[model samples]
Target: MRVIEVEHFEAWRAAARELLRDGVPAGDVDFCSPSTQKSLFGDESDDGGRALAAREAAARQRRGGVTVPPDFLKRARMVACHRDEHRWNLLYRVLWRLTTAEPNLLHVAFDDDVRRFDLMAKSVGRDAHKAQAFVRFRRIETEDGEQFVAWHRPDHRILRLVGPFFSRRFKSMRWTILTPDESASWDGAALTYGPGAPASAAPSADDLDEMWRSYYRSIFNPARIKLAMMRREMPVRYWAALPETQIIPEILAEAPARVAAMLKYGASGTRAVSAAEFLPEARDLESLARAAAGCRGCELCERATQTVFGRGPSTARLVLVGEQPGDQEDRHGEPFIGPAGEVLNHALVTAGLARDEVYLTNAVKHFHWEPRGKQRLHKKPPSRAISACRPWLEAEMTAVAPRVLVCLGVTAAQAVLGRDTRALKTRGVPFASEWCERTIITWHPAASLRARTDEERRRIARELAEHLRVAACA
Candidate 1:
């Protein structure tokens, strides 16, 4: 009826199996035994001792000399192991907490090691915590030269399995992984880490570490911060490994700066040239589109997949304006190549306008959309974002000097006409605006496609084409 405590579930289970093999009757064994007070944990009042002793007596009375269930015994064995009498039992206690099912049984088990169990309590899962804790190493200048090293005692002997990944990741450097039970190292010669040393050294930094940190800071999406999810994926313990963890507080305190920092890092803005220096010699629409791909003019570009630029003849007399790029345009990085473009093309030819006769463009260059699973559905840009992009569109018009302007949708109308007007209400009529001499507001072909009927789409397309013809001569 003796109780055995080992550090890990595997060790405890091994001891239990050894006891079973030695011909000990299951009824003679009592797993819920009180832990003796020890100096390491400081002041054990034996709070759970009586409960375990009582449960032990009852189990004996119910099934005296009965064999324990293999499944139940296996699980019990895992929970019974202990490493030391520390303020907390890092290994076995965590196993007990994970394997415990019934309250009565858990209550009895807790009596033996309540403080140890409490140390393992966390809202985050144990594996994630281990991933954080076990990922270790720091650079130390020792007599043996600068060697990358790490040391941490893991609950499991998983280093053999997961150690190789770190080895391959940091192959160029010499590193040592030290655990309570074993150690491993890749010192440009052989993998040497197994039970021996309790402490290990630190890793020297590679030149790319800063670059990696900067890149990490930049790509971190502020909009997707779900505190619960972030905590789940990255427990508090792992923050030490992440260099950008320093900015996490800053991220919470001032998210915009973090986001801007990230964008600038992603752009590697060191290569950025002044606007006057970067403009193309020819200054055509295609060249402008390519240039806009590097634009960080507004925050909308931050979420967009890529910059979508207007396409078509640069020398065309008429210029057609549409809303910001839609989903297809965002992915393809070319404007007016989507369904709306298809319908508009048919109308353009039907109205006696060659595809090359007009400069096809969008009011805003970047795609704005809400991601739904694999699809990025269109999100109408804010009026401010539209206004912010007006200069680029104006630059295109100023460079090409088109005869007439066609506002393809409400967003486009707002940009060119400086007033928001419904395409349905203003279609087929020419209006005067300060930006363009004569502009016609009409349904963007995308709106017609969403109407879901061919006849309605064709009708809107016909009206759009008719307005284009009128603008061609204007």
Candidate 2:
């Protein structure tokens, strides 16, 4: 067996990719790490060789083409975050099967390999949650400005995996989160990773500690305390670093008295459901339209004047989904009636398709916009909005039951195809999606309108018409 060892996820990915490219069977390779038996190879798995392997693997990834489902690679990346002794080997075995004999292997939930992979990924996901939840940052004064710092020791090598979360949550501020295995720091502009740090590197207290402790004490509901559940979610290992945990003993001792005092007051938990939950029992196009007008699924509904539903014959076989409504569509409560609509109309004529012969809709019925002077300029909907409005889109698809589904932009494609798909790179190619037999994605008419030059606009318009023609023929 050829010996290969990896210290991290990227290293394993690189080496596994190289091995796969060489058409090496999974059984012919031995994947281990320093904590395991790297020395058993008598220095063959040394630093120099591992470094070279990582470089080559990166080059291969850049060259593209890994045929496993997008979800497989996503899960594999998460699984690699785990420090399990056999994850590397298991990943390679599953990948080999996915590429060769069992292309639909991930669909088999009870299969041993898939189950193990799912379990490992779940553990990594939990570790990621712990890292995101429990790491408490203490404020410190620096020469540049105030910088927040925190220290944590995650159960897995999840520092790299969860760094992006910290960056997004604290985009405007500078902060540093230190762990035993790695450290991540976010300047106001960018996020950077450095070497591991000692717990002593983090400050034990900050000026806001007292306020934070006070707030924690105020919110601590002894009546709702479940020691077992709390310990499981907020593990004891993390308690030493959490300042609020220092007062838990005192709080627990006063539970009975607090419960008695709380009996004098009352709190209740009841909430209204969103408009999607208000779907009529009949579950048809007319009902969906009426229900969507009051959709409180997301904040976008608060501003959009009305929910713009699809327009076409129910018997239409070819359905087109756009990103969202433009200014004109939002005002008129229609799918396509703006400059983009004109472009789509022109493309339809060029491709020999009639507007009434096909269903026209959008991924999001609500228009998300920003103020640009006197006009409401269209903005890309948030991922949360995309997710919130997805059920409505699916309901439309079910009601229409179109034989052919066409996505007109990246956002719409992401909603229809799995969110992780590289929609741009492979536009005009047919995909098999749950909604239809032949799913095709192409340039949005809005994108063509935004082209910088006339030549580019013409080229994109031609491309859009060609894709429409392909969809019609399909």
Candidate of highest TM-score: 2
Q: Which stretches of candidate 1 lie over 4 Å from their true place?
A: 1-260, 263-287, 420-425, 452-455
- What is the C-alpha lDDT profile of model 1 across 1-474, one tens digit per residue? 666654334334444444434555444544432354222222225753454445445544544342433434433332232233331233333333333343233345445554334333321124323643346456666687877666555454445544665665466678777655556678775675445354423343444456445544544557556678667545675565555565777666667676677667668855332233334566666667556665656668667756676665667778888988877676545677667778888878777887655777888877888879967788888876776677678778877786677888777887777674566787768777665667788778787788778898777777777877787667
lDDT per residue (tens digit) for residues 1-474 in model 2: 998877667677777777787789999998887654332123446777776666775766664566779898888989988888888899999999998789999999999999999999999988997887688899998898788999999988788799987786577778999988778889977877777789999999976677556645654556567788679867999988888888889889988898776455333322222346645576688777766765657667656756788877778999999989988787656788788998999999999998878989998888999999969999999888887788888888989999899999999999878788788887998878888879999999998889999999999999999999999999
Model 1 quality (TM-score)? 0.42
lDDT of 2 at 202: 96
Each prediction's Cα lDDT score? 0.60, 0.82
Q: Estimate each model's TM-score.
A: 0.42, 0.53
Error of 2 at 250 (Å): 2.0
* Cα error, candidate 2, residue 180 (Å): 1.3
